[model samples]
Target chain A: MKDILTIIFRLTVACLLAGLVMGTVFIATDKAKKHNVHVNEQKVMLSLLGYSAKNPAPASVAMHEVYRYLVGEGEALAMGYLLPLRDGSFSFVTIDLAGGFVAQNPVTLAAEKAGEAEARTAAIAVALGADKPLRYADQTIVVTDGGKRTAYLLPGKFPGFKTFIGAILAIDPDFSILGLEIMEHEEDPGLGAEIDQEYFKNQFKGKPLETVKKLEVVKTPLPEEYLKALEAEKSGLGAAEVASIQKQYQDKDIYALTGATISSRSVTNGVKAMVKKFAYRLAILDRVLAEQHIATPF
Target chain B: MATDKTNLQLVVNGILNENPIFRLVLSMCPAVGISTTVMNGFMLGIAVLFVQVCSSCTIALFKNVIHPRIRIPTYTLTIATWVTVIDMVLAAYLPEAYAKMGIFIKLIVAFAIITMRLEMFASKESVNASFWDGIGMGLGFMFGMMALGFVRELLGMGTLLGYDVLGFKPLLFFVLPLAGFFCVGLMMAFFNYIEIVYKRAKRA
Candidate 1:
């Protein structure tokens, strides 16, 4: 009994020491880690829009962050978009469950608080001047080029083979997919993880929002011609040939990775759902903005 | 009790006679999984090296006070603490590498190579000796991983650290899990053969 007690005591001491050490490290590195993640995410957004270190995004390019929130509960539920106005302030535009404009309220939320969902929600609750339960849903970035909207960079997440796969989808003004950049995933390497490869991810490029809404994953092997076209930049194919190939398979289903059907299907379904929902929300937002004569930078 | 070996011997033993991957046959899982690319192998090796050294030194320092019956748990706690610290540091400073080696870094806590060294050497040795052993073992593991990565990436994808060396893939089979095992087996045989031949030549 005494031996058992001693063992337990020793184990507890070790646990305490481990807890203390980990806590200190977490506190020390938390801010830096968050900053790094934010920087990497910004880089991804720029790259997805065809900007890179070598060919930097133009000085006229502007990225406006828009936050989405699920407001209220049950029957009183509504969707709110915290939009940036042309004058550099913010407004919370609320739409009812039936896609009707409900209310618009000017809200003040610090830019740094964007990473903290609770803080954003609290700020929104105060602005709403109501007891409605609010939950921050997701964020979309509007990329503009000198007062002209270029692309919508939407962040999305869905379950992959192992865990959730986080990705950023860039869409043009007409809702055509500009590119897909996989940010995070735990899918098996050389199999499911191939989704991040250029050939696989670039397949989504040029796909319109309408086609993406019905996109499906086919188990058929990706054709040699199609694969070559998908890798046009590397294979040195002319822009005309790339466009022809894309047009040829524009309506066809996404070809699943060789042995990663689940992963392929997950991405296809996730992209479809995200694009469809975003289109609906944007339509409502546009209607509400027009009726209220409120000019948003987005 | 195993601390009789000189510092140099401990390191040499880890890299050659008692290689964690080839001779000791420890940590085969990661050695096979992440060794598909040389960069990945090197990154994982660095993370493992940091954790192993920290855990071994911590264990050696506290061995006297830790109860013998509960030593395993204490060693595990030390390893987990160090692994978390390294994981956080990597994510903060080297986000690119962290993204590539996300879950694998956390899995380091369960590596048998670490626990085995802590049990067989660190728990018995002086703090200074254990520290050297950890270095030796860490470097040996890193060497093994890089060697496997070098072979696998070259043959599997005809690339060396993402550069196209051969211009065409030599064998796609080498990139698969089966090929990983085959490469490990072949390398193991090659190491053993060299050892046998070296011993015979020395005797002559």
Candidate 2:
């Protein structure tokens, strides 16, 4: 019994040392670790809207921080904050559209509860196989140009054929897709995972809201006109020809991945649902701000 | 089993005699899973190298002090601690690389080759021997994965490290896990054949 107790005591000391060592390392690096996560988060958002070409937040962003808090609060929206540039135009503004009432911190996730009325509707949509119910607990950052909202980088999640796919949707003023990027996904690498490639994502660009509303991933080859337009554009067709082709394909549904139709449809329908909610938020934010004019902070 | 072996011999043992992927046939999962792309393989190999070395050193230092009955749990704790630190460090310092290979790094904590080293070599070995053994085994694993990745990426995707290589049509079969097994087998056989030829020549 004494020998057993001694062995246990020795093992306990070893485990204690291990814990202490790890604890020390964690304490030493905890600040930098958090900073890296935050920077990466910003980098993802910036890249979604075409700010940086790669990871690591660009020095321009850190050095020339452009926006300042301009006041605004939403009545119908959960929470809102406006950041206007030095020129008195809203450069970057973030708003929480998921919650029904305004709150101080946009990070407050008061309305994300599944039992909430809004969440119930989304849960029903999810049951109907629309992308996972929109639990966008964080503020959606809107990037504006010259007082006009140019793009929105909204984070969303959708249930892929295998697992939930996390993504950031970049949409233009009229809800035309700027781009879609897969942040995290567990689909078959070559098949379902190809959704991350630019070729698959590029098809969504310039596709307007009306088309995305009824978007279906059809297995049939693209229409001859659309194919010709794509070819003509690639062959550097003349300005008139390119413009005509661009116009023709502007509102068309996206082509499905040859083998992975379900993954393709998930992204399309997921974006459609998220955008519908985002449009609602934009409308609420616009009316609320226009009535208050609180964005004009000196 | 011999503790008196020189550090160089121990290192060479890992690289040649006990190569994790080729000879010992350890860590076949990562060897096949991430070898679809040269970049992925290379990144995962580096993560493995880092974890393997750290775990080996820690295990060697505590070999005598750790009780035999609890060695397995102790080794696991040590490996898990190092892996957690690495996972955190990658996320903190190399976010982009972390984003690409973070899942792979976490997966390495459970890798057969990593734990196998502690069981077979590090537990009773000298600190220097254990460290060199890790270096050799890790490098051997890295090289093997890279070679597999190169061939798979070249033929399966017509790309090398994401760059277009030959203008030939990609062989899709080569990118699948099924082809990975075939490649590994072919490589093992080829190496064995070379060794047989060398031995015959030496005897003659």
Candidate 3:
């Protein structure tokens, strides 16, 4: 019908106009948006290690980004780490199924490009050659102060109430939790989203790997004293008092958010899995590095 | 001459009589969800206002060409485009606020209030009238959200915009979704009461 044709034509025009406007705006803001995302991520990474805008990280404190790759399948399964060397270049170190050094190849890419997954995938394909099946896994950051390794930052995700919740976990050399920062989530606001609140996030701090692995979600209400201690910075509690309170509840199960038990459990499980996997992977990487006599930035 | 007075009335009507939330009872999702905090409510309100105004203006400008049968789809596309533009702009320029309000911005496309305004008001009105209507409805929605947020935050969290006013939580139940319903209901009753009183006084 003529009427139908007119409706279709008008809708098409509207679509084209909308697309054109969005395209222009996207192009205009693309650079600034990317820059903001990068800066915000950097701020989060630094803050997890006790550095903030007020007290900037010292030059001596360097954060090195190390990427993980799961290569091959079945018996041929191997783990590869794209590590930073002291010489300002990167190397892909592979450990085979038996945890023995397989091969090491130089990965040449700009530092920023290497940090991004797509670019890293291409570089990996180039460095490892065509025959190997490999996929980019995850990335971790190592914080070193004056060449002494201090902490490790792991970005992890797990199934939340609605979708996966992304979080960054900071751990010391001994694999004790330094802090947790919820990066992104689609959980219900005023409920599961409370996981990002200070009191909830601070509960993960000071938890050792043993405690973290055994952490459970308790449905009981969070105690007032525990809440105050967890939010010590805001509560104006002294360091000694905070430490004491932390020690008291260091091994206690995580108190579930009043109405978001699933979300609380999800995060607890995520932290446990992330810590366990990182510890296992790092142990293998460290041993291989020592045996191969290869120096790493971390 | 008469047009000037009607334009002002449109705005006033939006605020008091046909308030998007209180009177018409539209977009209860964000109302109950994000109204837990004043800042959250205010941020969402601003984003909604931008999208509403932009979409209404676009609809009014092209209403002649837009076939009545397909006007709904056109309105949706217009809203979607504007939401994306606003999302990118906020993410780029106001990343700090965007950090808190990013999800809410994307969720604006689903809001019934925007579509309702386009269909009922903007589609038939002049560009100038549609613009004023957009301003009125947008402001009414914002005021409604802020009022809900104010009551919810005050009683729910014992805080106003994250500041502890009561020093301690008075009623923890107010922070829950269940309380959102009760608060909206009470507020609606209070608004109706005020309107009746004002009408009586004016008649006297």
Q: What is the TM-score (0 to 1) of chain A in model 1?
A: 0.94
Model 1, B5-107: lDDT tens digits are 8999999988898999999998888988878989888878887888889999999998899898877878878888998988898888888878777666798
Tens digits of per-residue lDDT, candidate 2, A1-298, equal 9778877987798778878877887887787877775566667677766677645543433211212122223233223343333443332233444423332221211222422335433433333234422232434556655445567777778899899999888887788777777877888867888888755776676778888777777687766555555555455567687557767767767788778999998988888888887787667766655654545322
Can you give the TM-score per candidate against the true fold? 0.93, 0.74, 0.89
Give the DockQ (C-alpha) for candidate 3.
0.81
- Model 3 C-alpha lDDT per residue in residues B33-112, reported as the tens digit of each score: 77888887888888888899899898888878888888788888999999999999999999998887888899999899
Candidate 1 displacement at residue B187 in angstroms: 3.3
Query: Model 1: residues >4 Å from true position, as ranges?
Result: A73-75, A111-116, B166-172
Candidate 1 scores an fnat of 0.85
Better structure of 1 and 3 per TM-score = 1
Give the proportion of true interface contacts each model preserves, from 0 to 1. 0.85, 0.46, 0.95
Per-candidate DockQ versus the true complex?
A: 0.81, 0.59, 0.81
Best-first order by TM-score: 1, 3, 2
- For model 3, residues A200-266, the per-residue Cα lDDT tens digits are 9999999988898888999888888889988887889888988998899898889999989899999
**Candidates' RMSD to native:** 2.3, 8.6, 3.0
Quote the lDDT for A22 in model 2.
79
Candidate models: Cα lDDT each: 0.88, 0.71, 0.88
State the lDDT at A138 in candidate 3: 89
